[model samples]
Target chain A: MKKLINDVDAILGESLAGFARAHGDLVSLSQAPLFVRRRAVTPAGQVALISGGGSGHEPLHAGFVGRGMLHAACPGQVFTSPTPDQMLAAAEAVDSGAGVLFIVKNYEGDVMNFEMAAEMAPCATARVLTNDDVAVENSSYTTGRRGVAGTVVVEKMLGAAAETGMDLATLQALGERVNGATRSMGCALTSCTVPAAGGPTFEIGEAEMEMGVGIHGEPGRRRVALASASAIVEEMMGAILADLGAAKGEDVLLLVNGFGATPLMELYLVYDEAARRVEAAGLTVARSLVGNWCTSLDMAGCSLTVTRLDAETTGLWDAPVHTPALRWGC
Target chain B: MSNTLVLRLIEGMAGTIESHADQLTRLDQAIGDGDHGINMARGFKELAAQKAAIAALPLGEALKKAGMTLVMKVGGASGPLYGTLFIDMGKATPEAAPTLADLSVMLDAGIRGVKARGKAEVGMKTMLDVLCPVADTLRSLVDQNETDGLDERIIAAAGHALHRTTDMVAKRGRASFLGERSKGHLDPGACSSALLIGAVVGVLAPSSAR
Candidate 1:
């Protein structure tokens, strides 16, 4: 409640206006709580990518909107899924004709809401790829992975794939592959406030941190008094890598993501530990990204994701060109 | 059976949740990150603020308003689940806010909505585990002359079903992933449902005195 705003209800619209003001060259806000590619999308031969979720994970689903990334991004409220109307608008605004693909996180609300919207939206052909790489505790059987930090990487690679002129079907298949090959694990030292909730989403003792925590402040599988950055990274890496089953000699892409409110220095320190653990396990850490690539509001914590690399995937990983959030090989 | 009584039940339920938000949040903080209390509290506060309109409005509209409010305002599992619950009740309120029979059918629809939304069923350590059973119990109580001890029956049933939560393994909710560790803890969802229903029953209790 201590934040600056003209009206609490119009905050989303006002903030979006501010973003459009700053990033006018790259993107602009649409009528809906959506951000579309400033460039016209030609869907005839090109595969258009779209992804959306709640708004709090900033510089996310939206910031990645650009030439090489998502053609449209629909943002719901903080940690809430967009309604069908929003998604329908995004699909239409971005669809140039060839086809559109939706990269959705595996949370139930996101999946259900997206499914509803897709059912209503008319497009060439759309594929929905759900990301659930939590690596927390197994769900019923093998369906247990919860989508976490891996979404940022999957979007990057798939964005690059689309940039390379991969057809919708091809991009869809590649997205599915990336979704399968990734896993993420998170730990939290404190809970984040959901802005509207007006307070910390949850609380943790100063001496303790929860392990296996999900983004929504849902309980993690385990908790213990806070430990060293090295130990925390080791445990997170251990959980993620164990679930991944990547062999010691295998090469992998690693991302150490800050939940939010964590500073760059702290992230680099954690990354230092994570990189060491990856090498110590005899696996080749081919490439590593350390930053607030994905977050859970201003929650003080971090998560780690690993993407098993193959020649094809590594190429896409390298192919990412430009986005407000991630920019590299152009 | 009266619409007057039914409206009172909802108001009482909403009040109960408003009162117990802190306890609920504290419980959630244990197995999951907290927020149940704050979310539900905010949800009910919205309901209370529009108390006159909500009580006077057709049951479905009121419930739908409640559900939509939660959907927009609350986040995480509780919002969706409670929102779904109210949505279902609203959808069931074809004629007016639910009467006794309508309440029964409304709750069953709510169960279905939650099951569909959460992909979670009765065994999940969610509110449905309690709400579903209580709905069933209430249906059976509609007949029979008692009406006097009905509150006790509702409370007893909710309490009894809640205790069973200890034995069943959680299949959904955050704790469901914990597998066995979830066994000992009373499902927070179930406990909250009991509190809400207990409030409804309590408000109706003094009615017999009146």
Candidate 2:
């Protein structure tokens, strides 16, 4: 309720405008049907990578929209999915002669809106649905596992491949493979408030934490008393490792992503714990990323994602890339 | 129905949604992301603003335009789902006045569109829970040649359907993430859908009918 904003209705536009201005060198904003496209034109034959979701997750789809990442990102209202018009327009704006690929999280709203845009897109388009959260039970009776922080991993690897002029189909296939190999789980110490809602999405006791929390502050698997950081990481890593089933000695990429309010100090501490767990399991932690790359508004939490990597994927992970939130070997 | 009647129905639905926005948010807070009320109120407010323009069009066109407005402005699972409902219903409606049978067909189409858009079914603890029952009630009424107290019957059916959602577990949307925790709460989408249906029918019926 006590957010620093002029008006609730203008929060998204004003923040987007500021972001566009601050990062004008890397991105440009379109007003009518809102979307952020890379400042530089997409290569003549390179596939365009577009991904988006609700707005509260800072520097996610938008901050990732630069060189060697997403070509464009369509942002919706806080915790709300973007409409189809935004996606379609973004596709038309960025799509080169090559087709477009949509990196969609497996939320109902995100999936439905992106599906509508894909159907209405003028050019060939495909989607990579990320459902890497291992907390939820995947079944025909449910919507399957919710896509959490692993989306960044999928986007980064696919962006690298697309930058190398991979065709749309190849990029889509690579994205699916990366997503399949990834698993994530999160725990929240506190709930974040959506601007429009004017209060926390869910209330938690002072000493309680929601295990397996989604990015949007949805209730997780269960709420339990707070425990030590190492204990939390043990349980989270256990779920992720059990789901991934990576072989011993396999090189794995570990991403300890902050859910907005958690600082880098704590994130690094989490990364340390997570990496130790992975190593203890007899897996090699070849690549590691720790930051607030994918966040839920201001929720105090973090998610750990483990991706089983091969030589090809490891090479892609090290590829040159420059974006607002991520930069390496540029 | 005439354009004026359609406009009245829009106003009624918008008014009802705005008034109950807080309740919807409360319901969602229990099992979902707690934005349903805010999202629904914003969409209907926009729809109300365009009532004059939308009312100028024929019934089918007006419904389609209204649906598109909701889709563009709502920006959540509810937006596309509700938008599909109205859009498909509009597609099934004739330009001229639709009879009871035609209305039944329109409702059925709208329900089908919602199902396809959300990949959901009647028992998924979504708007479909309320909408499907209302559609069946309308169909049965048409088949039985019952016209008296039609609005009351439809409203009662929707109310019952909405209440039924309280015990159901969510299998779709953000609420599904809660698993068994999602039970014992009314689905916000179903609550809003029932409210709109009741509002629209309330406007069409005379006071004596109630």
Candidate 3:
């Protein structure tokens, strides 16, 4: 219940105002606070990349808005999906005539609203859905696999592809290819507290951990007695690699994502174990991201994502990207 | 039956929902993300803000305006679901005074709209659990040519349906993630749906007494 805030009601507005102020050079907030887009105008023939969902997952759709990344992100309230109107507005604002590409998560609300928006938008729009969580299928908020940290992979690959002058269909195919190659699994040491709820979502005993937890704290496999850090990482990574059908000599991009409250030291430990485990499996770790790129408020946990990469995807991953949370070769 | 009466009825419904916001939020916190109350309150507040303009329109137009406002202002699953109900009801309604049969048709349209938008069916532990029963009762009464205490009958049907949802497991929305854990808690959407029907009764009972 106790945290830094002016008021519960002002959370979205104030947070966005702060975000816009901090990254004015790279991004601009629309008047509605529904979306944030790149500050500069998009080229007339370039495909626009747009992605969004609920607001609790910080540094996601919004923070990824910058050069060589998303052109717009439509954020809803905490754990809620943005309405179609927001998407329509963002599509109008950022579309440069080539077309708009929507990178959506598989949550029911997100899918419903985005589907409605696509029908309402003025410009031609194509969509790519991220359903990379290897944990539970048909969980509380979605019909298929929950989209987790692999969304960052989808956004990055498609963002780079769009910037490279790829047409809408080509970018969508690339996005699907990356998503098909990616798998992620998450585990939580403790539940997160949603601000509006004013309490932790669930209580875990000191000796228990929630394996395969969804990003929104939806129930996972089952609560089991906590294990050593290395042991947990191995099990999570094993699930992902098995699901992804990864094999020896395969090159992969690794992502060790914090579920908000996890420390860098722990994430690095997770990364060490994850990278070592995959290497032990004879897979080469070519690119890695270890941080809170996708979060669930202040939950205490982390997830592992492995994307089996082709040469083209690796090149796109290495492309220049400048955003508030990420910067490379700008 | 007047357009002014319809406007007052909508205003009354907004007031009822606003008063119960905290109760709905509490119910949601037990099994789902706890923002149903805040989202619904914000949406109704938006409708209240434009009350003067809504009142100036005919009944069907006013309802449509209210529905659009909720869709724009409320950012969640409930927003689109509830907004679709009102919008569909408006589409089925006539601009002038409507009879009991006409009300039944409007309710049927609204309930169907919710079903299409949410892709939820009966027994899914959603607002449909409350609204479908009420709409069915109204339709049956109209078909049987029974008009006595029709408003009270619809209200009772909605109340019964709302209470029944606590015994069922959620098969849709955030609470569905809880699986069996979602049982024993009242569905927040169902509760709000009952309140909407109660709001209608509030407007009709007093007018009938006069």
TM-scores of the candidates are 0.75, 0.95, 0.94
- DockQ, in order, for the candidates? 0.16, 0.72, 0.41
**Pairs in clash, predicted candidate 2:** none
- Residue-level lDDT tens digits of model 1 in A231-280: 89888888777778887798899898888878989999988888888888
The deviation in Å at residue B8 for candidate 3 is: 1.1
Clashing pairs in 1: A43-A98, A44-A98, A132-A147, A133-A146, A134-A146, A139-A144, A219-B32, B59-B97
Candidate 2 ranges beyond 4 A from true positions? A1-3, B208-210
Indicate which candidate wins on DockQ: 2
Q: Candidates' lDDT values, in order?
A: 0.75, 0.91, 0.87
Write down the RMSD of candidate 2 (Cα, Å). Answer: 1.9
Which of 2 and 3 is ahead in DockQ?
2
Query: Which pairs of residues clash in candidate 3, taking residues 3 or more apart in a chain or in different chains?
Result: none
Kindly report which residue stretches of model 3 are placed more than 4 angstroms away from their true locations once superposed. Answer: A139-142, B207-210
Candidate 1: deviation at residue A144, Å?
3.2
lDDT of 2 by residue, A73-136 (tens): 9999887899999999999999997989999988888998898788779989999999999988
Residue B13 lDDT in model 1? 72
Here, model 2's chain A TM-score works out at 0.99
Instruction: Using TM-score as the measure, name the better of candidate 1 and candidate 2.
Output: 2
